[model samples]
Target: MARSIKNPKKAKRKNKESKKKGEASSSSSSVPSMPAKVWQPGVDKLEEDEELQCDPSAYNSLHAFHIGWPCLSFDIVRDQLGLIRTEFPHTVYCVAGTQAENASWNYIGMYKLSKISGKRRELVPNKSNGNESEADSDGSSSDEDEDAQDDAQPPVLQLRKVSHQGCVNRIRSMPQSPHICASWADTGHVQVWDFSSHLNALAEMDAEVNTGATNSFSMDPIIKFGGHKDEGFAIDWSPLVPGRLLSGDCKNSIHLWEPLSSGTWKVDATPFLGHKLSVEDLQWSPTEADVFASCSADGTIAIWDTRLQRTPAASIEAHKADVNVISWNRLASCMIASGSDDGTFSIHDLRLLKGDSRVAHFEYHKQPITSVEWSPHETSTLAVSSADNQLTIWDLSLERDEEEEAEFRARLKEQANAPEDLPPQLLFVHQGQKDLKELHWHAQIPGMLLSTAADGFNVLMPSNIENTLPSENP
Candidate 1:
């Protein structure tokens, strides 16, 4: 035992000397310059052994993903979501992050999941077949890396990281063209990327390296629009418009962008200058492809006609304070919801806005509602996120009882001690996050929704609700 201990000390000294020699030799050789960005972005954080608090029972979805981006401020992004397309038979999310204090080095990370638990056998792919079912136009996962597959340990199975430039404010995967996505940044630029190109190039590079051919990962943007004069914070790709994209900047200017026939994106010369203050958010109308709405810090929501840049079709004072978020009902052509800084949300019906546009007022939130979205699968279902760590999924299908409402109002008029009845519209109330920053309804998945905040992210589509499809009655 004594000899073993002494030998370890001697071995440590000799190892230190050999490591010094190795460093010297490496310095002398024609070493490749360190790449501008580290290739592995989220590997360290993803491999960090932490107990995942999200219970699988709360989510029936198979492909839900969690992206942990360590950003300094909460200025990551807001009001944008397109369901992530997985490179494998799983749900995937890519988050662009930087080191906690080092804002210059940004990382875009992807986490792929696999399951090994006995209970989750049905949820995960059956690997006994020995064939994977995922290959993308961008070549994200290819046959070249077949040997790289490892035994699953549950939860997360794979992770990849790529670096990016500028402070990315928002990223929205396009629905019509899944390969193309839009990214807006603080540098007043709207950039588009074809992930297929980036991922295909990466796969090809890996194949070359495996065959003893050396190369590097070079990611380039497919298109960039820099017409905004100030911070380009908001971007919304039209669900109805095939390739039309709408963007808003902090300088109260809105620019419409489209792909030209010449294979280039062009910004409209006549920018919409309707709002007097900074544009807070933008949402394309659900029913009309050519019509959309923009909420502003000036406490107004302006409806615009895309064909004419002359003036707004309608400008309604939707809030007493700055309107932070706006969402159109997927099923209702005239219903729109707006959340404001005054800790209230209003459901406005354009058909009934002749005098007062506010239809139903909700003050359940103690903080400003930062994000609001209407469910695509269920009619009259609205989800809103208050920074006060609450995500309320409300069902607006409740019918009011005339007698109950009249009696409650009479009790209020008499100042009698009567408890106000809980609105029947209240559905699921999710809480416990530090700050519920953003919420979105998945464009494709029925009843599915996603929310992210300081605590983490939540993906849920309540199964035990009256989720009758709108198509059933339509």
Candidate 2:
């Protein structure tokens, strides 16, 4: 899908409706079309139109977050209650490139995420905050959250912008780390920052020094991991091992970084050269600390064992075009999914230590596959995103009949173009936005999905998926 200048892409989704071509698309005659929303620009503010925009009963989705500049990447932020709110959570971090009128440097903004009638909203600073009335309590100022009056215009919350030296390509929120996130840029570097301490002091610092405008939180990098001569793009923080970082660059140089007690990251002396071309994506094995996988523009995905750094334990030329992304099944460590520019995704079973490796392959995409993520909650369920702006939820639970499998092998033996196919396991396919950049399963919620796209961000949930889970209401 072509990315829009008005908005960029990042999203996650799954649906209970079966999308097997025979199943009908959900009828939306009663559903109202989503309307475009505008941000007030700076911090802690949302436009107050009397009519509420949220209508999940009809739309099955909610519009959320409006960073003024178009964003390329984003990661979720946890609220103070530790709940995952797809709609205006406590905070969200996004990386966006410079606009025509802006400077050359790219920008990163930390915005307050919130919700109204289940609709997600980003509260940017209001340009008209000067005349806005904020309720005062006693001699002390009222809490910012409490002072957001309902009758008049809403008060601005907070918006902080930081400029980067290069175009920001990716951002990954560290697993289990409330404050730490890694941001990679075209400058061939990955920066890790812990902003938890900075946030609490921000308001106090604002009071201490009367800055006319909101200053971007000036948090320094806790650890700077660099060494790639080429622009670095692929990065993954090991969820199995704390503080172990992996980043691969355009030239296929992969470096390992480990955080040391001295408050710095130690970069390995030699780079792991596992691919002949740029590494497109890296994913840490969900079950193993010593194993990780890298997909590359060289049209292969290499499984690297950190213990044996000499070379990858296994490799496969899995596609006709560059392999753009990879994901490991969280429930089944032996299963791995890799997507390619050839518009196909192949699932491999690494447990098969010897013969014909691929277990299944899907080739329905007509454009480059941008991202793939295995659902944290379900076994054999995976999400695939395409440059064609499609999100397909695939359940790889289909088992093959022995006779049918043999027939396909016989055909492959007889004809050069013979095909091997897996049984239909498509659960749902959704279309929205101009470009689909990322698909992520909400770590805490089983049917909830967060998606980023060229037009805007969407928080979606499958209406039917609710029946399969233990409902909060029930």
Candidate 3:
């Protein structure tokens, strides 16, 4: 019997239904569409009238933070209660930037959560009191001084300066220290900053103080690694090793760096090259520190074992257009997910090699997949964002019948033994946005994900849910 052709219409309908069921189960039975708000210039607050333009059922909960255009950088800090630090969780920090000016770019003001209002507001320090300005010879405050001191007390919670004047694309916390690795586009430099000291320096830098006179303020980067003639697009520090770092550039090269005994860092090896076009994204394996993955504009994902010299240990010709992102499964090191400009996402298993040494592949999306991220906490859950302005989450652990699992295993085994073509499982698709550019999963939250687009809106969504909102034009 001849094999049946995969019907695109039938597949799409099934996916739509599956998404609806998933959303209905997770959220309250009712689903309502959220209306879009008009954009007004210089609006510093999210008003009640301007609720999220997407569906409430689409996201788990809304956490609003005002930001600038081209929001190129973000970080997630987990609280002791195991919740991702959104505004309601005491404090949150958000950094955003724009590339409007050449050579000189503006680092917008940093904002923090207000203790009184319970919303994000621009950070400003309280004024000092005149009576408390001078201390008595006995080192005790007078009655008048005591009264002023209370007024001059610092804000219960404040958003202080973290860094300034640099185009930071990504920030990765150090495994050992309280330091973080920050990659910059303008300087082509990667540096480590002590968070405590960095924040203090940022406050002084933004303070209204005289620059010509000597002041008790100094800000210095602890360690700086130099390379990359072009802009650095993506950077990653080894999850296992503290100081070892890997960065990819617009020049289509990956450079490795390590700290040296002389108190400085040096390039440990020659640049590794495999992709024909610019390298867009790179990530180190969660399980193995020496192993890493890189995706490029050449439309390929290459897995590299740093110990290998000439070429990648394994390669997947997965996408038809530029491969924008690739993420490794935290639970299964052998499994990988990738997104491409051709409007498709693919899941690959490195163990399933064909006769020609190609890896196994499964297709997921019909629009340019701009971003893909695997959940850090869950092994089988993955998230993807696309140019079609949709963010979809996949639950690979969903209960599957024995026959289905066996068929999938048989297909994988056949690819390992002999090359054969196969399609991937159709996961849920959250379609609502327009021109999506980035996708990120909250590090601490298992099901929460963030998706941003060129339309100046960054959305948060719950995994395994459907967005019931109507689509808007880009």
Candidate 4:
């Protein structure tokens, strides 16, 4: 949850009163009071009705409908938002709002597969030999006849929602429900909207609001957090863990919350602290519920095991500037990747220990690396976005074989000596008009990459079929 600090004047007033509470309390209790009266019939009934109307179910029904995909047209983009799958080859991408002297609403969009047409194909089931002859005699098709009628269809892409209040900086999907936690700059609040049941489901008309009025169920978030003295920059949900959330603020603090039986949420503990600068991102460990990672402007990344509160399980001072993002390798629990403002990206292996020491370092970048992500379906591949206006995919599997490294280096040298015969680096760059703010690979699809840039453009780069990138091979 996001919140602001109390005003200093108000805090001082309370502090002053507390210091003289004994002297002030006795005299303050003698204030006059009004006598109570019996309630009026009509007036009391109306007030009771108003109170009942404030209930969540009475106020509105949560409905999700498909909004057309957003058009990418913005200038001076500041961030990117995306959803992807590690097992499938698809991605949904959104560009952050832009402010190029004038303010216009920014939008989110999904990538389109060029070669695949947006068409629905009918499915027909096959018949086996036992029922084939009998079914055919009664005008019912045999399994073979049914099988011949089935056709493979490309997946249909749908636009989910459009933000009217501008671009969304951060978004997270809930594990237990089809809900999303979205943080917006316009309101400086995080909204939780139910969207799970809407996926692949048909849309329906929104229920009435005022009875005399027709109301469309707006994506007015069910719960709003923040809008206090501080604004939120990052938000995340515990994967597969219900009702657990974490959000980071500019004051360099992390807030944790859990749901209560009353249907409202409350703080679970004191804010987690360690970073001296604002935290840029937070990620829960893929394998462990109690473990997580946080990167900060203080040029460090710390791994936290919630079970041990005294200190981080591991801290790496691998960057010279703020660590913008950190991603855990879902396929390999012991591996993690981080991108930083110092124009470098680093991958660390927790399993490799050298006589009680750990190996943690970085590979340099030409510009500030704003985002980093490990392939959810592939163990050895990682992706990073940078201010250099390019996104690069890394093959960490290359590090495992000395012969492959030597061969790559030899190819590089040969390329330098002969301009035309050199082998290409596995790293591919997706060019943008401005600095890339963020990059994400699909959670289910291994190769599809989604990127947002400073110029207010979101692009989806599908995995090339010619690129025989290994899933676990890197």
Highest lDDT scorer: 2
Please give, for residues 1-474, the per-residue lDDT of candidate 4 as tens digits: 211110000000111222232332111334432211212211223232121111111000111112232222211111122332222223232222322221334333222221121111112224457745532342242222223322323333333333335445566555454334444343455555544333322122221111111122235555666633355556677774666677777677777666667654665446678888887788887678887888888987777777777366777675778888888777777877777777777777766522322244444356777778776556766777777665666555533344544453453341112122111223343443365676666453334555655544333332221122334522
Give the per-residue lDDT digits (tens) of candidate 3, residues 8-67.
Answer: 010111112223443422123254322122221122244543322233222333333334
The order by descending TM-score is 2, 1, 3, 4
TM-score between candidate 2 and the true structure: 0.68
Global lDDT scores for all candidate models: 0.56, 0.60, 0.52, 0.47
Could you tell me how far off, in angstroms, the CA of residue 187 lies in candidate 1 after the best superposition?
Answer: 2.1
RMSD of model 1 against the true structure:
18.3
Candidate 3: C-alpha RMSD after superposition: 17.8
Model 2 ranges with Cα > 4 A deviation: 1-59, 78-105, 116-158, 198-215, 398-423, 466-474
lDDT of 3: 0.52
Per-candidate TM vs. native? 0.66, 0.68, 0.61, 0.58
Top candidate by TM-score: 2
Clashing pairs in 1: 63-91, 138-196, 138-200
| Ranking, lDDT, top scorer first | 2, 1, 3, 4
Q: Which stretches of model 1 miss by more than 4 angstroms? A: 1-66, 70-100, 110-154, 157-160, 197-218, 400-421, 466-474
Number of residue pairs clashing in candidate 2, backbone atoms closer than 3 angstroms, sequence gap of 3 or more or interchain: 23
